[model samples]
Target: MNIAIISPGPFSVPPVNGSSVEHDIDEVTKMIDPEHQVTIYTRKCATYPKSSVEENREFIRYAYKGPTPYLQKIIKHIRKHKPDVILVENRPTYVLALKRHFPKIPVFVNMHSHVYGSTAMISKAKMKKVVRLASGFITNSEFLRRHFMRTNHIPGHKIHAVHLGVDVSPYQEAKLHSSIKKLRKQIGLKEDHRILFYAGRLMRGKGVHVLLKAFRHVSEKDPLARLVIVGGTGYGSNRLNPYVKELKRLSEPLGNKVKFVNFVPSVKMPLYYQLGDIVATPSVWKEAFCRVNLEAMASGKPVISTPRGGIKEVVTHQGSGFIIPPKEWSKELPIIWELLWSAPHIRTEMGKQALMRAKQFSWYATAQGYLKVFENAVAKREAGKQPLQKTG
Candidate 1:
């Protein structure tokens, strides 16, 4: 089958920097059946050429003149390629346009999150039209699926929850352990110190402040414990924004206990994970799904995350990692952090379980699942059957 993927305009295909959705798209497209051809439509970037074909897939970058012209170029490409299945990512507004202009093509909207920059300003009427036209909706987690269903008043059958996956080989225990010493040395971390890592955007919604607050309490109890924060202000931002500045202010009294590192490339993430004894993902907002938690688990490290959105589905309490409610992070996070900090045996056991759990979620498996969904949608479309209509 020929597949066309429409990536959001902000990010590039194959994700030179850190884009979880784009990375997933890249992984899944590469792992799809060799016989199938995949083409990704993404915004033009200096990092990538206008059009390139490699890894059994083609990437075409569209210029960002404006929404109308930008989408026109994409429509032209879609018409030229005439893919069997169209996978639109996140932007419902674009899906609306695609469905209106090219109704015969089976289009599936892969919603990465409940909110999208492109569809934020779109009216509810237009959104309903988009939902009605798309063959089906795909969410990364059950939590997101349920949330989308409830919030959008869409039927459960119309949406499918296919969990995002990590490439577990690089994060295998042996590989992670092999690089730990050198990674620690490079970051000026002492061998004896226990590191707690947070490796995503340094923003308030990500609960970096909450993590810092909890870390302060943990540091007071365990003098050897250190917190290492990775990443800059959200995606695409290269500077230490106000949020990072506030985090620095919050970490002032903690002194050497808190270390803030600038953004690390996605490829180098395993080294950072290897340097840490525990991973903390204290996102206060409802994260549709967090790839950081999966990556950490794949690296054989226990994660301490909030039970927000689909996080509980990933991090089970006392199974792979511990999940504390966001509201109770101040009271609960430090205690859990202390527990993992004090007991190396427990942490080691949980780390093993984490690695095992991580194995269950693989990019190849996710790709296969998506293929099944795509085939079903195409078959239904060809049969002149209407999509599963949304009913309250």
Candidate 2:
């Protein structure tokens, strides 16, 4: 099968430290390439290092620079390639572009999350219309799928739920000693201190402020605990928000215990995950899914996440990690403290269990899910065009 994946994001396979959407695109393409031809389309935001390079299997990249007729350019490429299936990552702009340009091309959209909740890209009404136009819709979690149906009136049959994939093989029963020492030395981590890690974009919906508040509670109990936040470039208009500021303030009392690193590439992320004893994601908004949680789990680290959207699917209360009730950090803090104080052994056991569970989710599974969607899209397209026969 020949497949084309379109993304409105800044890069085609993500430069390094990119969003979960970019990571998903990369993983899916790599997984499917062995059995199928795959190509990725991304916005020409800036100059890439190379025009094209074949890394693994059969994968190709087409990037355009500047903002000159992007939709027209994409359409031209589609016409030239005549791919068997086109999978467009669900961004509001791409939805409109596909609706206008690739109407009959059997476009399958991978809906990352509900637009009504946290993503400030499209409004409720617009999102509904986009879902209606898609030939097939996919979401990472059932929560997002239900949100789409409830808000957009989309039928249940129209949506496919495929949870995000992870590579558990590389991390299965792996030693963290080397990775830990490297990351610790790089980030100035202390030998005796226990590290609590948070990985994701330092944005509003990620709940950086909530993390700080909870950190304060955690620090009150274990003063030596260190929180390492990784991501954000600290560049231009998307500068530090109020949440980042609030975190700085909250961490002040704890002195140098809180540390923030901007823009750690995805290649180096596994090390950070290895160094962490626990991973925390306190996102306040409804996330489509959190890829960081999967990485952490695969690295044999227990996770602590607020019950929100797709996060619940990845975290289980006292199973993989603690899934606290929404907005209940005050009640949740003690649980975090108990784990920090009494259960170092449980942390090791749970970390191993987390890695084992993470194995069930893999990129091959993600590719298989998309391939099914593509097959369905082609079948549906053919069925719609079949001429009606007169009844005898």
Candidate 3:
């Protein structure tokens, strides 16, 4: 089967920087390649030069750096390819554009989250309608599926929970002591200093500021603890929020104890994970599905996430890691600190458990599940039968 995936995210292919969604695309393509042909459609902002067409590992990438009017060109390209099924990843803008002009093809809208915080640019009703018109729907977690049925008014049958995939091969235990020691030296981290790592957009909705506040509280107790933040200013947009600025200001009092590395490539993330004693996904809102937590778990690092979205589903209390409510970081941090300081062996044991749990969610399984959905859409269309539809 030939498939076309459209995403407004600038890096549709293997994004040079690092993106969980792009990582998903890469892993999924690798798994489905021998049996299917896949093409990815990505957007490029005006300021940056567009990357040339490159094909590797059985997938081709097409980039659009032109103005908004070039969407017609996207439709034309899709029409020419005549793919078996079209999958659009997020971005209600593309959904509105395609639904308005090109609704003839069987398009599936894959929604990763129903987060209504900063990026919830579209109305819930409209998003639900887009899902209704599509051949089928794919979501990252049951939390999002329930949000669709209850809030977006979509039917249960139309929605499928296919959690995002993570690569666990890198974290497989083989005595990575040398690699860990190298990273510690590069980061100026001492042997006794426990590393607490956070990676994601340094934005408010991501709860970075809140995490900073909690880290300060943790610092009061454990001065040797280091907080390492990894993420960029977010895709060429320098528009800084006050909370982000405050985070920068707050990092100062800690001196060199707190480190912020703007952005690291996805390929190099394993080293950072290896350096971290514990990984945190402190999302303010219910994250639709956080790949960061999965990556930490894959790296054999215990995760500390909020009781939001599918985070609790991914990390169990005292098992893979701990799941505390968003504002309860005060209540949670001490316990995490205690785990890191008092129970080093227990943390290592938990990290081992996390790696084992991470393997259960593989790109191969996710890609095969996606293939089944695309095949069903094509089969239904070929049978001259309309997919059964339901509205909230």
lDDT tens string, model 1, 1-392?
A: 88999887777877877787788888888888888889888879888899999866998998776677777889987877799899988877888789777888888889898776234666778777777888888999999898878867668878899988888887764463666777777777897898899999888889999988887878888888889988988565658778878899999999878888888878788877787788999999898998899999999999989888889888888899988877787788678877776777899899999999898898888898899999987787667765666999
* Worst ten in a row by lDDT for model 2: 50-59
For residues 241-288, write the lDDT of model 2, one tens digit per residue. 676677677778877888888777676677667667788888888877
Candidate 1 to native Cα RMSD, angstroms: 4.2
Q: What digit string (tens of lDDT, one per residue) describes model 3 on residues 1-392?
A: 87887765556466665656666766777777465777766655443345443343333334556425445667777767777787877554566667665566678777777743113576656665676677767888888878777876678888788887877776554236467777677778899888899988888777877777788878888888899988866743334667668888988788888887767777777777777789988888878888888889998888888888777767878899888787899667876877667878988899889988888888888888898888887887777766657988
Rank the models by lDDT, top first: 1, 3, 2
Of models 1 and 3, which has the larger TM-score?
A: 1
What is the TM-score (0 to 1) of candidate 3? 0.86
Give Cα-based local distance difference scores for all models.
Answer: 0.84, 0.73, 0.74
CA lDDT, candidate 3, residue 216: 83
Off by over 4 Å in 1: 117-119, 173-182, 385-392
Question: What local lDDT does model 3 show for residue 242?
Answer: 78
Specify the highest-lDDT model's number.
1
Looking at candidate 1, the ten consecutive residues that score lowest on lDDT are 115-124
